[model samples]
Target: MAKNSGRSRTGRGASTEPARKPLWRRIVRGVLVWGAALSLLGAIFLGTAVFFTMRELPDYTTLMKSQTGQMIVVRDRDGRELVSLGPSYGKWLSYADIPPIMAKALVSVEDRRFYDHPGIDALGLARAVYVSLTTDRRARATSTITQQLARNIFLNNSRSWTRKAREAVLALALERKFGKDQILELYLNKVYFGGGAYGVDAASRKFFGHPGTELSTAEAAIIAGLVKAPSNYSPTADVEAAIGRGRVVLGLMVRENVISQSEADEIDFSKVTVAKEKGQDSVRYFTDWALPQLDMLLPENKEPIEVWTTLDRRMQDAATKAIDGNAPKGTQGALVSLDRDGAVLAMVGGTDYVNSNYNRATSALRQPGSAWKLFVYLAALEAGYKPDDRVVDEPVTIDGWSPKNDGRNFAGEIDVRTAFAYSKNTIAAQLGNEVGFGTVAAMARRFGITTQINTKPAMVLGTSEVRLVDMTRAFAAVSAGGTSVEPYGILKVTTTSGELLYEHKSAQGQVLVPRYVAAGITDLLQTAVATGTGRAAQIGRPVAGKTGTTSSNKDGWFLGFSSGITTGVWMGRDDARPVGGLSGGHAPARAFAQYMRVAVARRPVEPFDTELKLPDWQLEPDDEQLQGEPGEYSYYDENGNLVHPDGVPGQDELPRYEDGSVGPGPGPGGVPPGVPIAPDYGPPGAAPPAANRELLDRATGRSVDDPGLRPGQGAVIPVPRVTPIPRATLRPPAGQQP
Candidate 1:
């Protein structure tokens, strides 16, 4: 019984004790399982990177020889380089011809262990991490030359580790496909070297004016330094900074033992020809305008070609200076100048192309204000109206819309020519209604106004939106003796070998108006420049232009031309807000004068048209002796005081009509003592209309030009009101009859 109990106790103790666990199962198996899980995660990550980075790699072979990658050079009319677009590349350099020292310099600075790394430099990464941990300076991480090439060729420089992993995978792929030297060759040929130069060959040519094959140690170091921060290290940006970077590169080369310290010190960076950064070319305004038209001219021609344009660099500079100096701040200004043949000589789109690239000259559409009167007068001339004919400047309603003069200062019974020169809004409205509004729109369209013209009474005051180019082009037609012209920029497109691709053929649009009509128009415009609203636009020469100020001064424009040259200037806010006290004769006309002075300085002073009665330059009548003034063009001076041209007699010098029909002068603040500005024909052989009889009876018991006339007064909206003056009765009031 004792033995049985002892055995049972031992058995129970043995059963109670657990089996001894194996150390291999507890540690090795667990480690293997965790390692497998980690490996699976890494596989998934690598697979995703491969799919994203390698999904569609560019055909590098095709890119190497692609015409699309070639640069196009644009030349001014003088054959000087205006701009260069597309990838700037030089001669393709193979690895065999590359200098060992050049490669060493780049390797020393950009990638120290470039040759030893399989694809990614782990040692470099570890060293970078160690430096980061130990010092305030942080070394560059894992973007080796190969990795940079991969990213440059296939991936974007997105600031993320995800992109880094993709860059790493691409680097591995590139290394597997190309040998180290071949990889270096591709990298040297594809990397951006700043200043719009891409690749080592271009960089070498840009910085040294020599090919990559002729690079010296200093130049090579300078080029190598650009890989990190091209703009910062570019000698063009700051020569001192660039040379310092080059010195650092040289030091790195010396440390790598690729070159001795003496050899590094012997390098002179002073001789390095740093390319100038094209910060902003005022000519860029013209180039920007012309570049896009190239695609349309030769859509199929993509080879590297030289575009010889019609831009006169002199005029471009003048235009830019005029706009920058004169245009008020917060207001955008634009100018366009055309040669006699309608070749665009100069264009200033805005104050600075760098700040705002919007080409206001061609793109912006705004109201032309009184400048729209050109079309009104042209339409009237086409409808058998003569400049010297009599036209009453009186307020009448069109569908209950009444047109008022600039300051309600209507010159009643003035000659058509005088009224037009004065920019009498009521007369213009009368003429617009006399000739159908559709006729005015047709005239505008015939003269290159491609915008939609609203054929309404309001069209007379230029309520329609029109581009500056449209106005310039329209005026160019008048400058061309009425033959319409299409403004052209690209004169010819030829390859470097002089292979003709495209040449501008003078496709004259059409003869918009007769030469006599053009001469009459010139006569009126000259009068305007002489004693009218555009007096500020005169530049000691025979210049003719119209001034247009929109209601509320939202837009100001001066479209004028001299012999063989026509230009347009516009000043306004882009948002269509009012420029306080803005007038077409103010900033816009001043800018026009400034630009045109330079543009015409060298050219001979010529009349607008030899046959046209241009303003008599010698007519300097004494202001006191200038008696019986029929009318005068008026404008507000810089001081905001309403004034007239020098020696242009005011209302006090007013004359009387011969037909005994007298009313008021066109001077500011209507004067109504009954002074006739021109000879009036006897009243029309018909009873006067209700409105006409009332106005005529009040104007001068003389009578109406046409009692049946219902010439609608085209209202310029938001007219500035005038002070009401006490009317002097035509007949003596009850006892004062003359």
Candidate 2:
């Protein structure tokens, strides 16, 4: 009876102790049960949400059919993009064309489970969720390559839960519709790689100057790193930061076993050469000039096409440097270079195209200044004026208008060759008068000067306005041995799909000037460069050109050519104001020389086709003249002054015939007959000698021998001794005036 009672008491005590358990234990058990219930409900909710998201998603076919904007690319002769017009859409590259390393690097860095996952990686998502829950931070991205592609192609970059859900659904759809390789190719060809580049192919070309198939491991890694944030990792914008990102990619590549550790280490990031972002604005000048001709070249309904131009990238760069380096501040300039066939190799329309889109090279109709003299001289050559034909360079008036030299100083008795070389305005004006202004204008038109020219005498000095391209084309005609050239920029235009739209078949034109005439003109121009105003433009090779400065120094020009290429450079104010007295010889000529040196560096040296031909008088007299022949001896000093063989009169002195005799005879000092001598001799206050007085009357057209002299005029007395007098003090005989 006692043992039974003890057992009952022990049992009662144990039950009472259990009923007195800690409060914390009961609270934890209740909370866990509630947490389990909530978790189960959340799972159901998520599953339902994903199902609805997938149902509402667009068809994969619809997504694939969506097209982006098209591009109109302008490639150089070598198929390099000089300028790309329209939207930035790169050419579609297939999976086979992309380098395998590029794909491996992208997968290693962007998504490690790219091939195994069906749009989403369950393990990656679980890891991301576990990390977020443990650290109490925002969830990290576990987006697979497929999900990122979906977000890129189908959805906007919004961080909302709805967008994320949509991205996952679209990614699953993409995986179901396309193979792994196809999706990757789509990603590569669709991703934005900054700097207006749209695809990996474009990005590769933009940053590496080559196609994706040629990418080295380092280059592939560099491009893969740009996927995260293109602008931040652009090699051209910040090379060091870009290289740092590239190293990270290479490290990731090694860890993923996509590349060996040794391979990553062997990569020299410093050796990677990033192609500079081409200045679209800089090449717009050429495009602007070339666009208008596209319609004429192709049919009206032509599709988007690629225009292959004649531009040589190297020459264009050289031309730009030449013009920008030499052009003065606050002034504008233009440069145009063309081949012998009239293919424009380089065209710089203005100094800064961003500041002004006005293409000065082809559009600006500024005065060509002395460049117009080319046609005038060309006309004179056609009119049978020998290069050595002498013309008086003294002051003259025509219709009460006078044209003065640059310094208002005249060079007396200059031949046509020397006159053109020295750019003597007076001689050009006289020749223009003699050849008829209409004839000169016609010659200019025939030489490819389409601009309207004023028939006035001032036109000989290039007062009329003309386009730089027109002048360049005209100069190209001379370089081509008188064949007219119509400057063209487009070489061919073809559709992106390889359909031929338009092709340039160089049209042959008639020869406006005779080949011999062009050659003769070329000879004179060569002399101009050797010893005349265009001396500054010599490029160590045979070059012929002209230098022209307009009145008031408003415009300056240097139009010249090599055997294969002809270029024209012009400098002046846009407002037609003086360019601070910058003459053609100072800046324009220098710029021409600078450009031609680099442009023709690869071409062989060539000389002018014709040799210089001088007149009989210009040749050195033979031994007979050395014997002091009465009427055959004459010589000119450096200053072009006529002197006796004995050298009595220096360059500063003038020889005068006595009594102003109009007949050819040997007078004192063996002075040649029909030559007028200085009448004003000795000091300013001194009187003329009796023989000099009669000679002065004959020179004034008052002698009986003078046709204009009075009918009853008596003949002069015996001839007086010849004397040397100062050239400045020598006056035209009384009846003779310049």
Candidate 3:
């Protein structure tokens, strides 16, 4: 009692329990305790989430099947791999087959604890965070090999915290479900090394030009370096940077004891070879354009399919070379080539596919300038206007907008053929008005052009945006003698096991124009190529095509067909900026020449069924010698048979020649030179029309469209005699004029 009293008067005895803290401190303690409890609950919740996520995670089999389903391998007509739609891979390499040095290099540079971690790499991650903060070593500081594999196999290549969390959780699941060796093998076989290459095999072949089985240690080191930044460290993109990264990998290998320091030092990285850069890989453009069609051809989520396409490597390579060699700086080009049946043989969408993958051939909708004239002229011909008919090319205005010729003076009373050859905008505008702009748009649709076409007068000058492929197909219709065709790419699709999925069946073409109409258009195209803006595209053969230049020279095009191969070329800046001095008759035409020069030699396209003939007095007046004695002459072919552009010639009232040969006069194939004639002849052995009735134009000697007609009456409208070709020719020029 005395001792207690001696203590401070505040207390008699010491309390057995600890002293009470102040209110603020107690509140802080309570908060800390609650925080700890919540953290524990969060941990339990995370574990449960991991349990469910693991359940949902794809197994090895599912991973492989999903990848297989996404992959679409394309083969050219000759069965060589052209391009791949999804992740491209070579033969799969097992962990044992993977160079032991390759594994060590990746593990050393990517995750030192790869062999020991449960895929999450808790300690390695901590060290990595510490090293990233404290050191200057620029290496792969996050994501273990297993994590990378998980992200690549199951998730999109997107960067986000959610993605990372999923990757971490999935990595643990991978370790829990799969053996370390199995995971390593998958990672080795499923990693992306850029340039459309996936897996060690594809990376090996793409980078070193060798099989993965034959990779050297230095080469392996280079591949390991790409895991951090595939595009940045691409061997093709930057060899020096790749080698420097490879050196880092080798140093890491030395630290990991995967290789002796002496061995690492002795490695000759200088001898490391990378694949030569193909100037421009344009083949991918075709594949990308055709990939969407693949989905329509195959079942959804189907196993890997082998696509046999109509792509011709020779033509494709030639197109690429031409575009790359001729396209001006900062400009791009697109080319589309088709057969008479409209099979797409070659398509070059841009100058450098790596720089831009937007397919201009099938997708870019640039103004065509005068190339749009194909439809306008066709519409006029269908409306009873002959190629030799007179068309005014003087200044014209429609809807308060006047269109002028490119030159100071206009060829005022030019023949339709002349106006077409020269691509006269005034004449085209006049013709568009005469036939109705709607009809011109209909004509384009008739020829398989599906792009939206403006019905305004400027549309005649190609002011309406159009695609290269669609225009190419439009020309293909004329080349096919009036039969319309749709451009096609994939010829066949099959599974790897030879299971046929889809096979192409060509449908009978729908005739969109009369054979005479086609010949008339052909005549115009041929003359343009020979003497007009398309002259630069001349292939020393009968080529029917035209040149188009847009306003401000923004887009230039040369689209034509010779010997059955129709090609369309477009050159311009992507932002619609002017390509200085570029014209359809210039770079685009030159490219056409370069491509066709090689294309014609590959196969024999039948000469157009109709031989090019001299213009009439109402035609080609230049051929004056064709005018024979002033008496009516009957028609005869080179074989001495009477025929017209798709009909049997009138034989009942034919006048006889002095030689008693009926129509053996001085003109070509026996027609009087002075007498006006029409070069309308059907292909040999062509079956007559369903009615089987035949008629001839008395005024022009052309096959009339009817079975009956009065004397002096004519098929279409009567026009003065002028020299003319079998096809329409003659036009006088200017924007998207040439």
Give the per-residue lDDT of model 1 (tens digit) for 1-738.
435555554454556668978998889888999999999999898767655555455455754544325577788889976777787766668888877778888889888888888789999889899999999997768589988887786678898988887788988766665689888888787789887777888788677667799887888888889988998988777889889998999999999999999998788878777766555766787888888897789867655678899998888888988888878779989999999888999998988788888999999989999999998998776544567756677776655558888887766677768877789888787777665555566678778887766655777898888999989998888888889888889989887557898989887567777776788788888888888999999999899889999999999999999857899999999999988978999888999999898888878987766353322221113421443232333433333333444423355544445566544555686445443222121232211111222342333211223222222345222221222111231112244222
C-alpha positional error of residue 670 in candidate 3 after TM-score superposition, expressed in Å: 41
Q: State the local distance difference test value for candidate 1.
A: 0.76
Write the residue-wise lDDT of candidate 2 on 1-738 in tens digits.
445556554454545343556889878988999889999997787667656666765664454334355457899889987776654545567789888999999999999989998888988999888888899787786688889888877788898999887788778767766789988988887777777776787788788988777889989899999988999999999999899999999999999998898878889988999887777554789889987898787777423468899999898888988889988888888899999898889989989998998888988888777778898898877655667655778786654559888778998876788988988888788777665555566677778777666655577888778899999889899988888888898999887667788889988967877666788799888889999999999999999999988877888899999868999999888898877868898899999999999899999999888643433223224533454433334445334446553434543455444564333334566756444443434444332222234443343222223221111112222211222122333233345332
C-alpha lDDT of all candidate models, in order: 0.76, 0.77, 0.77
Cα deviation of 506 in candidate 1 (Å)? Answer: 3.2
As a whole number from 0 to 100, the lDDT of residue 122 in candidate 1 is 90
Q: RMSD, each candidate, Å?
A: 15.7, 18.3, 13.6
* TM-score of predicted structure 1: 0.65
* Stretches > 4 Å off in candidate 2: 1-93, 108-176, 214-218, 247-288, 295-308, 328-330, 350-358, 380-390, 411-414, 433-439, 493-502, 516-520, 540-542, 601-738
**How do the residues 1-738 of candidate 3 rate in per-residue lDDT, one tens digit apiece?**
335546666666677798888999999999999999999998898778778888887777676545533567789988987765666666678788998888888889888888888778888667777887788974345788998888888787787979888888888888888898888888888888888777888799888888898999999999999988999999999999999999999999888888899998899988987887544489989888887896687777556678999999988989989898877778999999998777888999998788888999989999889999998899877655677676666776666558877775687766888988988888888777665555676678778776665555566788777888888988999998889878899999987556788999999899888776788888889889888878999877778899999888899999999988999999999899887898889999999999998888866655555433432212223322463322223345433445443332465634455566554333456555422244433444322221121221222223222222112222131212222222222232322111
